[model samples]
Target: MSSLPITLSAMDTEVRVSLCPSCDRSISCTTTVFPAAEDFQPPQDHSSEAHGTDDASPLSRARRAKHQACAIKSEIARLKSLTKELKAHHRSLVELSKQQLALVAPVQQLPVELLHEIFLHACADEEIMLRTIPYTILSAMSFSRVCRTWRNIALNDSRLWTFSTIIDLSALASAYSRPRGSWIGWDEVSTFKRLVSLYLSRSGCRPLGSLNISASYNEPALKAAVDEEPKLLPPSIFKHFHRFRDISLTNSVIKWAELRVRASQESLVKSVKIVGHNEPDMSTVLFSGAAHLTSWSQYVDDFVPVNLPLSQLTRIVTGWISYIPAFTALTQCRALKRLELSLYREFTMEEDLCEPEILELPHLVSFRLCVDNPCILDDILDILDTPCLKKLKLSWAPYSGVDARLTDDFSDWEWPKDEFSRFMDETKCKLESFTLEDLCIPPGVEVELRKQLPQSTRIVVEENSGWSDEEDLDLDDLMSEISKSDSESA
Candidate 1:
């Protein structure tokens, strides 16, 4: 190992060509020879003799030494000067490479349209960000700070600015309830309105994606909470109602009157979701005439508002709608293809009471009705008919939302199977799917019911699992325990 390193070290150094004296072998090797080695001698110092200072005084000797030192110092200074220039040259070469490479960067070559798409994708969670962050432009503003080009592109691309705003309930309520005469209160109101204006202007007349407004505080739990909702966006914002495509309002997110204002606009609204306790008056239509509406969700409890273009709607979802309102709104949906309803179903003895002129949803492919009362099924099936219905899902729940165990002696809870069979036969609709969830059904009846349906129909019966089993105790064993305990006590 020692000789191997020495051979490699010599080969790497400058080489020489020579003939070996002993064996006449050609040798090519470089030798490291010092000036003080056997073959070399340095010249003797003769500076003192030439200067005639061999017998000089102590001061003269010291002066000669100082002169020698000065010459050595000058040599070092000259070498350092060369080093500084070399360092600067190396730095310039490194920077030059960086500059040349940047000219061919992929990001630099990306077209503006492509770059705009990247920015939109970067803020894909626009709705989530709005829900969590107070500022609407924070995502845009953050991206803009990246570079001047991104700033220009993000600001000009109206699609990048289509966003949702989530305002806290308390702050929203106070913005309206407080007097604007006070500077502090006025500042808040103006600040909120300005935020809305900024969004509208940046969107550049593009179609607004969605407006999701929610209350910050729990209005039901607060003490002396204001009933008024802060119109987060000013009235001027609504002037561009044609831009709105999706809107969701919750918990008095906006005053009921604001909804009416939105209803009056000839907006190109396609989907709407409303969830609140205070129902708008039944007379006031949701969207006075929404021609473009195709999907709607109505989750209010009290009263159903009218304004929707029900005939143009294809999908409808409602929450706890009673018999009258359900019939009223559903009957108007001439184009309804999918219907989901949760109802406070209370049937009357006067089954003849008008049930909205037999809702004929010829286009309905899926129909799901949730009723707590068992009798409500008869009411619904009697008047409503969907000829093209491919899926029918029915959920039978109790008014308390829970039911006790099914027992042998319980009252007859079997829904009139014959009535359902007759209804399907009359509609002339061949169902492809059917689901019965959380209901009490007699044993073996599921198989019998399946036999009656069309061969193409897929049926599922989900029994009330919580209450299906009955614990039968033997009377002999129970009596023995009772008698034994009684005798011991006596």
Candidate 2:
């Protein structure tokens, strides 16, 4: 084998190595011994020497030194190339070792059934499941991308694909304004529709837990597209209407009317919520075919007329309605177990053409009312009768004179104790829990009210008047007094 020779030299405590062409083995030399100063000889002047003489001329020596330097540089380049190859080989070996270790990893050894259960739990994390636009699909996609095993598990599990699906068609409306030839082309709407179709298909035959669809065509930019394609949702969505358990429609009046007309009688829908403004006459009764619907919620800027199977409903939550209409709706819900209402106006002269009769809800177990006018609550208490009432929550609406009611001493405020006492006596229903929210009540009055209720009943008094427990002077003392009264009552 041919080997490149190496020469090592030391001078003034510095060492250097270079290739030696004259020898096969490496040569080493050290300049530890130095001549005495007096015997030291200076370099000879070779400028006057002839180039052909036995001694080398200065130019010849310079050329020889240059050749030596070039040889050293060539050797250095070869060694560097060799070093790079070695490093790459080392990296490959390390990666191979890691792969071997991973084969024996504890997590990789877990049974496929255990891994599937673990993945299910991970998908159900509150942080992932409770998002405004839920990340359930995104999380499942991520898990499937991890490895083949996980991909098969996630894709085959129908439960992973049946969470709430929120379709915001307003996004489609905004897409029309994008500059021409942008990322979202004219076919963007069809692409989104296909995506929704695919998402629903992935759910297989599982019931969709909730479907929230919101769309608004009020934007002037969408007028042309609206004329071209009146419907933003894919027709495939309606085919799955029988799978929906809860449906929420916001500002989608036209779509809502269509859905009500096309809803399957076999729909598993149990809850319905509608939120909109200036809704057109939806002469079509809402959810008339949903025999399983037990809960209804409505929020509207204006009073949109609604006709549904009210007798079948067990829960109703409504925002801001006139007193007469509120009472009229309650009368129809004989099976209602829970009722929540926010009354905006008292009875008008036209609405109260006849004397108000008692509104009886025999099956009502819970009642929550928020009134803008305190007198409205007084009227409700006068006419309301709930024989099975167990929970009652009353609060002042935001528009009510809450600021005026909040006082340091609550000396100017007094709860309608007489009306409440009369209602309690008339209903003859034992209340299990009573809550008073956003109301300023004198400590003495609170004590008196506590004395009237059974000791076993739970009473919660919340005053959101910016007064902390410590700032409320003598609140702890009043609480002790309440305890004493409870003991006496017992």
Candidate 3:
């Protein structure tokens, strides 16, 4: 039989008593129950009612909820405190990483000297560097950003920071050829100043050995390049110019006033090569500025002038020019040791009436003459008197209608054989080597000219210097060999 469920009072639930002791003495019972859970009014919370701590009153249930809310609030405060501590630990770890980086950086592990050399190599060579007007950003500056140690070393070494200025022909064309009255930005100029500042501050007292300032352009590739490239650059950029050994500029004209300032400041520069400049009036200022120049390459204009400091020059190279200027210029170079001249086609029968004034270069040694016409060559040699001349090279460039040699044919032209013979006799110099290229000379005339010089003079001809065609080889191998010999002897 199913007995009706009995509800236990709160006191009976806590303390058990034998109410059915007379019926069954062996039966044991659990002390917790509240009317078999169906007596509770609330639909949920059977766990509270069945556990014998029954909160059947609304006031009792409210008090139990208040206690649970306080516990949850305490737990939230603990979690927030823990989270704050963890963040502080994370910040400390970040500081530790910075310290570790200093010890582990690769450059810090190497000696300072090796790193210095590596830094030097990272800087680009002056000759091949492009867009150098402002700076080579990635070339030298990249190494400085690797680490703090690297930055210090790179910044301290001045040699790595030296830069040669470059004038890009294409960019110059675009910059200068803008519409009239348009503003030009000083982007390139600013870049040059920053580079100069960084290099000078770091270099201390080290001399910048060499620099190249050039207007680079391919004339045949674009007409715009030739027309738009500036004839002369402003001298303001080079105002701080000082101690340098070599300065080479090509294909652009420059201010004579700026050159005068540079020459006055830099007296020890050994060489200056100015090629294809438009102005020849200021050539006097160029030589005057660089009073110690030993090597000079003058191709300033198609027609060169003669007012220059030839007294200090030991070497001189000229581009294609007529006979008169070459003769006038060579007359003053008393200290010249080596000379190379490029001659154009010029002839004058009137040269007979006025015997050209002869120039005596007592210390002259090596002379290389490249000519297109034989008469022009004869005209140059008649006036130059060199007593100490040793090495000589005569390069004949092939030209149309100029093929006829003055063997016996004087009907059309004049030969300065007597004038050349006279100059040779006056110098009385022992010629170590004489090189002739690209033209045939009669056997008798060759032997007679050789007899006038020292017996040891080696006469080289076109057939000997490995040239199947002169136009194909501009190097002139015979002259190259003679230059090598001169260098070795020196």
Candidate 4:
């Protein structure tokens, strides 16, 4: 028989149960039925007619949402706290990195002795030092930037006190005094002051070894300094006579009187070089400044007027205008071992008169003469009086009549046979090497010159005025063929 549908008939309570068919186990659940009409009285079975009780109450749903909102708020607070902590940690790390960098940066620590050794190295290889390393080191100011220890070491290092020989003293002073300098301007000034004081205290400027001042583009700053503030630089800067060993100046407008006044105090300046567009009037101050100059290179509008009684002077190199007079003035330099002359725009026929009687350099071991005219060689060979002359280089262009000024025929020119033969005989024992470039000689000349040699002399003859490329192999072939013929004949 089919079970009849049952409905609860209680006033306010109701219950329902379903049974599993196999086990007869009852599964409990609840449901409520509600009145459909709005204006109805309680139904007879009120337990089944409570419609609102079947759905979740608004208060219960609201309670569950409140709990979920609280949970989400807690999660957001936790994330914000974590983010703040991470930021704090990153800031600390950055600060620590900065501290570490400050602590570990490389610093110069060379002592005075070590610095002196370094300076010695620099002095030995002046080209490399001036061209590369010193500029690089000074450019970075690395020594100045390190901690107090390095700064102190660098400041106290006397080698650091030295400046480039080619530098402008005025510019250097200005840079040292500028407000925005790497080191405080006062600090640089103080350092320079201390160095000057130290150098001056010991025998005035005796400790001041070398001074070089130069300016280009016609800047008048240094000259102004010398003139206006002769006292600004330590009188020791000029007054200490006899300590300096070298002096070089170029394109300078300083007066000779001032130079002599300054140099009179320096007893030891031995090497001097003066160069510029216009030569200084050095005649009056020549021997007055220093009598011990061993090496001199200068350019004068006229000949060197003053004779320097330089007994120790061993080398003389000059460019332009007054070489004959300059050589005559160098007669006192009996110890001179080398002579170099660069004839720039020959000024007179007097220059072509290279007479041994007038210019005698008996001790010269090496001689170099650079000129355009080959005819000058005749005069030069006649005047070569040095029995000790070992090397002779003549850079000249033969008269190929290439220039309209030259003649194709030079047969009419007579050789000074007596003077030439005497010079050859005198130089034969000493001349060990000869270099001739852009030169031409009659075929018999070379053989006769070689026969006069006391010992084997190495002669190099470069024929063409222009350099020949490797593809021009005809000369090489001719040399090879000549060598073969010589071997077969031998």
Error of 3 at 75 (Å): 18
Best candidate according to TM-score: 1
For model 2, how does the per-residue alpha-carbon lDDT over 233-332 read when each residue is reduced to its tens digit? 5667767866878887764444544644454447688998877664565442656677788998877643534567789899988877777777777788
Higher TM-score: candidate 2 or 4? 2
As a whole number from 0 to 100, the lDDT of residue 3 in candidate 1 is 14
| Top lDDT hit | 2
TM-score of model number 2: 0.62
lDDT of each structure? Answer: 0.62, 0.65, 0.59, 0.51
Candidate 1 residue-wise lDDT, 78-112, digit = tens:
43654465456558767888997787476767899
Model 1: residues with Cα > 4 Å off, grouped in runs: 1-104, 116-125, 128-148, 170-197, 216-242, 256-264, 279-286, 348-356, 400-413, 463-490
Ranking according to lDDT, highest score first:
2, 1, 3, 4
Q: How well is each residue in 203-316 modelled by candidate 4, as lDDT tens digits?
A: 233333465655554455555545544433434444433454676665343353356354435467677776655545435353455656778776533445354656677987
Residues 1-490, candidate 3: write the lDDT tens digits.
2232333356224422222222432222333332333233443556645665546656565565555456556545644554465456557756888888877776578998998998788674532233453343545676778778888887888787665555444444554455555443245433544555555565565555565555544443234644433332333325444555677665333453353355546555688777654554454454465666788886654656444567788998887776666666777788999888887667553653365476678898999987766666666676678888899888766333355543223234343568767777777877888777754454445555556656677776655223443432222343466569889999
Clashes per candidate, residues 3 or more apart or on different chains? 5, 0, 1, 9
TM-score of each: 0.65, 0.62, 0.56, 0.54
| Angstrom error at residue 206, model 4 | 7.5
